[model samples]
Target: MTAIVEGRSANRVVAAAAASIAVAMVGMAYAAVPLYRLFCQVTGFGGTTQRALAPASAPLAQRIGVRFDANVAPGLGWTFKPVLTTVSPRIGEQTLVSYTATNNTDRPITGTATFNVTPESAGQYFNKIQCFCFTEQTLQPGQAVDMPVVFFIDPAILKDKQARRISEITLSYTF
Candidate 1:
């Protein structure tokens, strides 16, 4: 009878431990997404661009081309396109570009944009000083708006072997 009681107690302890582990795993699963996004923003992993408060102090002599792309998700009832297909700016030079967004629906629609840089290695060096993507945009029926992005390519890219040879970078936005 003593052995039976001991065995039952051991089983209960095992069950409790399993429950604790399961709970902890569920907690971690919930935390994983935000943690991964933070990691990507900090490290510029996955082509995530960096944010900046101000432009570079002095522009570099080397010029690089930046291509712009705009897209609207299906069912959004919006039309979007870049004002310019591409622009050439000296490294470290602050530049402004615009995108046009028009609401096609009969009612106002709100949208937030997500953006990324191509030539993924250069994402860390691509900085946006001001971007419409930073906030939610609302457009009334048949309304159109011009959104701007102020940005610079860091001069530090010239020092990084992987990014130095990149002659062009593509910045793409999706709403």
Candidate 2:
């Protein structure tokens, strides 16, 4: 009886350990994409720099809708907009993009923006050489400023078999 009780307790311990590991693994899998994005934004690996996707590409058979979205946190009161945008670019060169940010709330809003080149597959070639989107902007209430982002496409983009049909990309922001 005593041996059986000990075996059961050991089994339960092992089962609990397994359960914990499974849960942690699931959480990690769920977080992988976002964590990768954070890593890219922090370290512009493979031309993955912070900037809006500039519109300068050849037109598609039909227009693929690309939308720009802006977000400002409650404590950070600011209004942001897309001033310059992009859609097409030569494989080796970059596209330019611009945005205007205004301090709407009474206090100054200072925050950093982390952006991704969605169809993130495009991120592999989107290079932001000079981009205001990478830096934090501090605006006094009622203060409005224009931000510029200069970027280019990686030469490799032209060679990417998976990316061949992709022409238009949208860059969005959240504070």
Candidate 3:
């Protein structure tokens, strides 16, 4: 009789432990998204760029070409394109550019933009101080808006061997 009682008590303890582990796993799953975003922002992993409150104080003399590209998802009923195809700027020099968005549909539509820099290695050096992509945009039918993007390349790129070799950077956005 005593053996049976001990066996039941051990089984209860094992079940409790299993339940605790399951709860912990669920909590981790919930935290994964924000944690991953934080990691990307800090490390600029996987071509994820960074955001800045302001541009660097000084710029390097070396000039680099920056090209802008835009794409709209199918069925989005919007025409999106870069106002300027390319610009040459010195490292750490802040520049402002615009993208023109027009709604061709009969009703209002909202979209959010996602952007990435190419030559993947240069993503860490690209910083955007202000960008329309930071939030969702809503446009009424036939409405046209010129959205701006303010950015600069970090002068520190000159020190990074891999990033230093990059003569041009392409910033692409899609909605």
Candidate 4:
């Protein structure tokens, strides 16, 4: 008679099930990175972290009032007409911004957008609560849509006191 293994109960089916469960659990653990990133982006729970197209130099303060600019680049057949609202928070407040995108191309176009905050000093405090950047945007010929973003600055920023040194903030968008 063959000697039975003591630990596994000599059952092949039981071993197979255990192996599958282990594999499945390992797979889920590996997927945690992308899953958590998706959750952050969708809910804006953490400080909005996005890959910067290129390293941006720390921003310089102009006057006491910070001046922010919006730079947008639409896809080959798309057009962007941004409608930005003025933000004058006490350096620790939330603001809303809106943009209008139009499909001027003869053919339908679908693409995504990515963005960054310049003047590393400002980026630390800038937070995007709601945005469409880095998301797939589908536009049909002559189709236009309004995109909105909600953002807020951490109150801790003011505590830095150095934050007051920052005047203008720029929120640029590139498609």
Highest-lDDT candidate? 1
lDDT of 1 by residue, 1-175 (tens): 9999999999999999999999999999999999998987888887888999876569989999999999999999999999999999999999999999999999999999998999999899999999999999999999999999999998999999999999999999999
Q: Model 4 Cα displacement at 69 (Å)? A: 4.4
TM-score of 3: 0.94
lDDT of 3 by residue, 1-175 (tens): 9999999999999999999999999999999999998887787776778899877578888899999999999999999999999999988999999999999999999999988889888888899999999999999999999999999999988899888999999999998
RMSD of 2: 6.8
Q: Which digits, one per residue and each the tens of the lDDT, describe model 2 over residues 1-175? A: 9999999999999999999999999999999999987787655553254443553554223333233456666667777878644445445454456778888778776888856666666666566677666677788889998887676665555567965567576666776
lDDT of each: 0.94, 0.66, 0.93, 0.61
Deviating ranges (above 4 Å) for candidate 2 = 1-69, 85-87
| Per-model C-alpha RMSD | 1.3, 6.8, 1.3, 8.3
Error of 2 at 169 (Å): 1.2
Instruction: State model 1's lDDT.
Output: 0.94
Angstrom error of the Cα, residue 69, model 3: value is: 1.3
Better of 2 and 3 by TM-score: 3
Candidate 4: Cα lDDT at 19: 99
